[model samples]
Target chain A: MGEGLRGSIETTGLTMIYRSGKVEVPAIREINLTVGPGEFVAIMGPSGCGKSTLLHLLGGLVRPTRGQVLIDGIDIAKLSDAERTAVRREKVGYIFQRFNLLPNISARANIELAKRIHGNGHANLYKDDHILALLGIKEKIGFRPTELSGGEQQRVAIARAVINQPSILLADEPTGNLDSHNSRLVLTLLQDLNQRLGQTIVMITHDSEAASMANHVIEMRDGRILARTHHFVYEPEFEGLF
Target chain B: MTHSLVAANILSRPTRTLISILAVGTGVILMLIIGGITTGTLNDYLNRTMSVGADFILQPSGSTVFYAFSSAALPIKLADKLRETPGVGAVAPVLAKFSSADFGLVFGIDLATYDQFPGRLEILEGRNSLQGNEVIVDDLYAMSHKVSPGMTVEILGRKFTISAICRRGSVVRVFVPLPTLQQMNGTEDKVTIMFIKAAPGADVESVFRELHRAYPGLALVRTTDPSVLLADTRMPGLKEFRLTVVTVSMLISFMVILLAMYTTIFERTREIGILKSMGASKAFIVGLILRESVIISLLGIAFGVGASLIIRKLITTAFPTLQVDMTFVEVLRGSLLGLLGGTLGALYPAYKAARMDPVQALSYE
Candidate 1:
């Protein structure tokens, strides 16, 4: 793990309740969790398990009804909507199950949009072609999302997520829409990114094989943590892995 | 990258983009064409009136630039009195009437007396004299009405022989004998206005003041100062009429843009959600929408300007006597107003898109 103080997170009694008129439905109950910097954590759960909701909370996509969400040392739960958005832009990158690539723009444009949002629109600190080559998508950057396959779209989405070299990545089912062969390829890339960049990654998945790639595995049910498991994967160069 | 996104979004819906462009273009066209016609007609009238080389015009109190609207209220004796003034060089009495057939003013003047001015009618064809039951027409009106010397045409509901075809740029297109028009209108010995010239080396300002003092009850207007002639007080409801045209044109662009952008935001809800997840702020979203609208407005303005120029050509071709002048300042005003309306129209849609719930928007199918 990188020796950086960024990407550390902790939630103290984090709770979220949805209200529709007089009806109050709790999407997530009181939850306590902590993640250190440079950690690769996988959240495993079934549908309706609030795993996606938790990912959204970690990414600052929604405000919690109660409790605190701390990133590094700042409590984001107390920040205004604009402040939270700023934190998200500066620190968090998200990957969705459907790949969520804008259908009308080219793959390179999608990735560049992330850089623009992070206020590095005209900078060239991190080369994008190198990242696309690492993700095995350098040749397909000119095509729109609809012109690419599901696997190619997911690769572009991952490129967009990490384009700014954010401190944290919150991915909801990174391979849910891929075949088994593409799924393994995506998982291997995610693992390589986590190991090489030391970016704190929180991925949600239903496949055990995909979860096995993470350093830590967490299981959740009914919005509550059921189990926390720790494991290690063999470290090897990415030249022949895929 | 944001620019690419905006371009892709606009290009993706070709029909909607085109409709929006046409709407904005239509608004600009309305403003330019209507404004051009109003300004052109007024300037044409004022120029021709000034071209008569008259130092001052004497009319009844509260007379406007539009001589057709005025009655024969000034007595013909006023012309003799004006001619007798110390600085007055000459006075020509004109009884003006609106000719519906020609869509212009018809002037009645005594040929011998009207020949005293510098802009005296120079006959281009046939006899130069104008007498009872005889009419004189300018070259433009003569060609447009397809009449020449000795051709009989109707004027003031009476048939009169075309005695001559004069050069263009006269004060009026058609001319008749003063006694004939006076007998037809039962306004004998009373004329609509009197054109007065200053004697050589006479101070025009001093002459103007003398005339004003001599005729306290009448309205004496200096023909040299265009500003004085075009003053709002001199032209009733002209400013309001122009404002009405501009407001209506702006409203068209605003409403069309508002509807176009409103529908666009709803269609791109999921896309906006993706942007939000990518950490785009509300300001960024708003900027994106506004930028797209601005681009559309620019395209519309270019199209409108081109189309307005063509329409102007077509109008002038169809009616040679009509004038439509579109100055650069007028075009710029229309373009700026169109852009403003379009930008304002996108505000609500931009706000709605920026305020959308990211979670709900993401899940929207």
Candidate 2:
């Protein structure tokens, strides 16, 4: 259980292929990638370039057809499904494009559910309050997801993801559903937590502005990594692909 | 956290939840009311028979205890022979027939022979005589039919005046003269059953044993213990009836919950995916589904018990002859079976939810 918080990811020869009715379709193929501890990386690609597949593989949501995904020297690709779930539970948090907040429960309950899944029980209600405050959503904690704006629901999802203090946070188009204002607020919060809390984040987005906020940007095309860039100004090159 | 999540899930869809609850509740009601009536009727028959103050009741071998179903009649001369047995004090011969008009039995008993027992028919109103076209009715029958003394009621297509109204809880609610009923039925020398009483200081067990030896061809059933009366295997289809009621009740609970929870899981596919993505284990997902079912079952059980009690009271009040035994034990038993059915029903749905692929589930619309 002591899988500590120094999040370093290294993937060697990673590949994923879907097979259906005698036809083989490759989603991600032979992609070697690495991100240092505490770094914020963003992946940008057009549709079918395997950006989402890579993120799913990284978060252990889907098993790779071939390769090794080493998170802090532990290979999740070789682990059993249950063992991988434990690794995911212990180290990775996901922010989906749709928020995925349970609509039947309140924002506070959605956050507490992560703690419950993390096995912290009632011991961390005070800690959850602090996380809600950090995200500037303490007031809307009692409201259900149906009552919240897209931005607020994503914020609750973020609070849920990070409440367990995971080593890696995976964001799949975190600002995809929000307006310009909400997009800016969520991006700012992500960057704030990445820098101050030393949280490792890998985000996939079509927005160059959102990708520009990360410390590193990796561009993908045809199911492979095409280029990498450090924190730079938004270039028009990243905007037209998606 | 599990219970709260389950509660919130159920409360979110008020219409669906209520339908499930009501379906389960309806199952409970069927089990309680139908089963209660059957047992109640049998118990009432046994109690009234025992209350006749008879040590034993003699009937033909293999004759059904429910007199309506038993057409075999003992020869009236057998009563005289039974009276000659040592320690036998009195023997009352009764000729019984079921009247479709009242949906009950009409007993014809000799006044002198019936009055030999402690629960004799007390003449509450008109003359005690059962001479020529006279009838006796219980208070319940009198009140229900609105018949008073001297009112002529056609029984078996023959007109008879209500000569007396006796107390209720007797073997039969309606009574007629033995000789007249025998004459009309064309069975003057035959009787359905005989209530036998032992003389004072008589050893009743020995008397019954001796009578059993003498009347080896007949069912000399001892009525001293009420259990023996019910245990007599001649009562038609009682065991099968109870079993069918229980099985049908459980099937109702099982099928309703199975369908409700199965549909629920499919509707909440994306929520299940979200849970799985949040690192919820298989047991956690299963626990969530089963917890919701348990809550629904509990609500259904509560509704069922409350409804059953009200129904029992209504039935007993409106139809005084219907003895509905809604005992605490019966209620508890019905509740537990309903819960078991619900839990079992939810298992397949829970398993399906637990085994869902998170990637595919999250992709569900």
Candidate 3:
């Protein structure tokens, strides 16, 4: 996104079936979707609607039972676990609902883990501090995760997710564990990141308030997409938005 | 950053990590000192015997070099015959006796003949004469017993005056007249051993051959080489003792490291899941765990080496005859083995953590 690099993502006939002791449970039905480069999409659904599973498939966390997922025009569903892991490290950055920060390390260390996994050694690059300051978490870098509040921890997780400047970010319930004040704050930060960096973001949420912040809101029910609605929140600074 | 990432997790549980280190250290110390003293004492005795400058030792057949187990009363006439043999320069008869009270061996010898060798007894603090009812004690024995010259002491239930404090490292710490010891033991014409020296500029091999031929029933042992003395088949259980010590020591490190790392992986399941979700490879996770283990092992090895050195010093002070060899090579062998055992013990746990399913691990409460 920084250099208008490719960020196109697509899935065809995505299907998932869970088997437990010979009992078949269909978690996802056939679905086809495409996201243009630099698009900000929010998926809204009820519990057990397979939104999380879809996010996992997009991130190459699990193999799809049927169908293929393509990131930047490369089909990740055809890759092995190790290959998919490599793709995830280089291309997709995931933010979880729980904000999985390593408790034993400082906030900076939690964010730096992403850079280390990206094989950046300990250099931190030229943009790491800039991203932390952009997220308003530069002051809490020295504090351990346990010393930080829930909202602060989630902000650190966000910083970690985008530190590598990945092409795509797949977030599951980014605001599910936060209060209204913190939820709005996190949503505003996500929107700011999307508009300022032209980064592709696919976030899952249950609140309509959170969904309204995205350029496009997708409604899902019973493992299928029910509707696709555009918000049309056009800002002059985001003129080249996809 | 990677170093601190692994170190922070280990430092978080200081008690568990320290216990693991101490357990490994204790194992290494046990292996080095225990195995060292066994061979140390044996080599020390052999070296002292070689220092006597005796070309060969004549003893009863199949007798151990140590006199405690041997009371073979060979005729004192063996010395005159050994002296008459060609290539023999001097022959001194020794009536060896073990004094349980002093934990030392007492040698009864004729001063004129004993002084003919290169390692003649040198009295450090008193007159070197050995007359009726006179005894000579080495420096260590004199210092430990607090007995000086002219102090009458009861040895073998008989009273005798301490006439001299001789230099240490001699074949025996206490010495008296040969006839006096032989008369007291009721063996008037018998001696335990004879120290024979080859004539200067004579062929030692020829002297040994003539001695062996003349004393076929007696044990003629060459004292010039330590390996020859150590190669005696009568030294029972030395190898087995060393092996047992090494096995027990390695087992301690192996079991402690295995249990500690096995428990560590179980406790950090969620952390493993997070690392995996962050796109860390199996090799990366394994490397992290091994790095922490290596640090712990190095610390343990340092502590073990230091403690062994101190313990060796203490042992030598407490018992002068006991030697504890802690050469650099031996210490290196011990530390390396300790590290190897600890590293091997962590392999299974590291593999298990690498193979964990990220989803399952993350969901693990």
Candidate 4:
């Protein structure tokens, strides 16, 4: 496999509806969007705008009523559940808003879990140390989720998510529970990962300030894309500067 | 993940683990106790029934009825003919009576020939042979009746001296000379049974066949055979009662195991879901749960067997003559039975846990 090669994501006529009793509420309606390889995209909208629903649909976490989600030229919607899980394991990295680390395991074990799940043989050989050093959490490897600060825990979560080195990283308000200082730190890490590693990042956030950190921004309202913005890319001069 | 981790996971919840172990332990203990009692009592009954020193029992043809109530009589001449046959060592005629009034048995034996049989009697007091107007009562009966070696006792309105007190077959017995018994009962010519012994290397089957051929009306039986030992023996109702008791105990053990396994699965619903989400196949999840259950069951079985053995030892010590033998094979059999019962009990819960979906499991509060 080629290192630091990003994968593109595309959705066509994606429609999703939530049904409870006799009521049918549309979450995402006939939406079409595309993100190029190595592109950092952000979805921004108000509450109940189906931003998370669209992200879930694109990630194959939820089945769309009628649509196609293509990742790296293959329509993931056509894959079986087991096959979809395999694709997610091999190609997609998910960072949940809640930082869903298994509470019983230590920080290093949490990161090791991802590698083990992907059948990586070298999971135990300095991989935890490397990820922790990259995230500046080398000392917190032995700590469990309860013992870490919000920022440190989210960093551990991010390390766990990216341990497999997936082609696409999906973040659902990764900084929702952090302070501004931690939020900036997490956002800068995401941006740095996308630039240096060329890992495609698709983030969903309600805050415009958070969305401004991305290279592209898409606005959604009532299950539809209200607007899209493409920002100018600024290539940093120094490489390996950390 | 790893075997060590799986073991740690199973043992992490101390309370749940202990409860599961206790469930298995309880079942094993109950099985051990019931099995011990059944084997102990059955053996005791057999020893007692065979206590008449009868190496070979001769009854009527096809007269394998196992209750003492069967009054089937064998011809007295069969004993004389068996003594005349080749390889014949000794023979004795016995007249067995079941008296509801005394709630015991009275055997009319010839003291002259009873000495040839092993474990014939342990005379506790007084003379060995039954003299004129005298009888030998069992030690238990003598103790219960406060009768000593020379005391005169009345039986069925006939007075006789207690010539000796003896113990045989774990029961309260009384022995009178055949002539006196026949004179008192007015059955001088009839004989209820015959006990025979053969010389070393004599084929018992051939002798049995010859005896049957000689006296076609007499049914030759071996004391060791389960069918023959049970024939014309009292306590069929007691055997049936013991069987019912054992069956009910097993059913209770099964139910206990089922309930415990079901609760264990129910409590681990979220953990199962997590494993499934971690790419664990349904079979893997099921295997893990089953491993956990079997571990708990085996632990319980071990504890139960130990406890039952202790109890059995205590009982045996408390009553020296009451034999309690629990072989290793019996314990192994009991443990395997427990394992099978535990696995059967856990099948439904294992299936339920395996069928759980990851998304739904993670969503559970």
- Scored by lDDT, the top model is 1
Winner of 2 and 3 under lDDT: 2
The docking category that best describes candidate 1 is: medium
- Scored by DockQ, the top model is 1
The DockQ scores of all candidates, in the order shown, are 0.79, 0.69, 0.57, 0.22
Angstrom error of the Cα, residue A207, model 2: value is: 1.9
User: Model 2 over residues B1-365: C-alpha lDDT tens digits?
Assistant: 66568889899888888988887888789889988998898888888888888999998888867876676378989889989999999999999988888878888889888999977887777777776799999898899889988999989889999999998877888889988888988998998999999998999989988998998998888877777778838666888887788788778778888998999999999999888888888898999999899899889989988898899999989988788887788888999988988888899999999989888999899
Candidate with more favorable, higher lDDT: 2 or 4: 2
Instruction: Let me know the DockQ for model 4.
Output: 0.22
Task: Give all TM-scores, in the order shown.
Answer: 0.96, 0.95, 0.87, 0.74
Per-residue lDDT tens digits for candidate 4, residues A1-242, read 23323478889999998888999999999999898788899988777899888877766666788889887877878887667667776777777677766665677776666676676637665765666677888899788788999999899888877777778888989989999899889988988888876788899886556677799988889999988888823344421111
**TM-score for the A-chain in each candidate structure:** 0.92, 0.95, 0.92, 0.90
* List of clashing residue pairs for candidate 3: none
The Cα error of candidate 1 at residue A30, in Å, is: 1.1
lDDT of 4: 0.72
- Give the alpha-carbon lDDT of every model: 0.89, 0.87, 0.85, 0.72
> What order do you get sorting by TM-score, best first?
1, 2, 3, 4
How many residue pairs clash (N, CA or C atoms closer than 3 angstroms) in each of the candidate models, in the order given? 0, 0, 0, 9
**Inter-residue clash pairs, candidate 2:** none
